[model samples]
Target: MSKSKNESNGGITAYSVKTKTKNVPMIDPVIDIKSGRYIATGKDSEGNKMAAILGKAKAEEHIKNGDAKKGTGWD
Candidate 1:
């Protein structure tokens, strides 16, 4: 058996409403801040867009460590 997309890409898991799938791995994940809340957004394997809310500190860490891209309006 082969590794799943998430395992192969080490992507963050996010719920995908479009695919109706839970724990879907996010592709090209980006971190952004909105209304003082941290958000993680990316695409699923099927190319469906997904997003997950994260904590402020955790999001900042990902940005600072270069684990995720800083999305628009993120400073």
Candidate 2:
């Protein structure tokens, strides 16, 4: 199961601490090619998407089609 807490900035960040095969803290993005981690290029305030991005093919695909949004940089 997952849990959620309120954010001070009035935004909601979802984190699921998995304790199965591995203990994963789902807060920061783990930027490794094998891990397939990614970071958002921040939001396009005027619009509803990011500006541009730099990543591998799959990661780039995520920025384009995944449920990616702005988050604290490289946390």
Candidate 3:
């Protein structure tokens, strides 16, 4: 079986403000467009909310490829 994009990329990572950590792996990430910007939101190991800003092209590509779910009420 082929590995999915997220798997190949080692999954999504976000900086954890609460934990004061960098490159923290995100769980159950979802991509959303907020105020004309692309953003990814999920949880950390301790179930703390985490979010990361993503590039426009990258976000659009992920959405188009069905690798990410379109989030509602993200704005």
| Per-prediction TM-score | 0.72, 0.24, 0.71
> Would you list the clashing residue pairs of candidate 1?
none
> Each model's number of backbone clashes?
0, 0, 0
Per-residue lDDT of 55 in model 1: 74
Query: Candidate 3 regions off by >4 Å?
Result: 1-10, 64-67, 73-75
Model 2 pairs in collision = none
Clashes of 3: 0
Angstrom error at residue 45, model 1: 0.9
Global lDDT of each model? Answer: 0.71, 0.31, 0.73
Say which candidate scores most in lDDT.
Answer: 3
Candidate 1, superposed: residue stretches over 4 Å from native = 1-10
TM-score of model 2 (CA atoms) = 0.24
Give the alpha carbon lDDT tens digit for every residue of 1-75 in model 3. Answer: 764333336466777899998778777779878788778888988999988787777676666766566796343
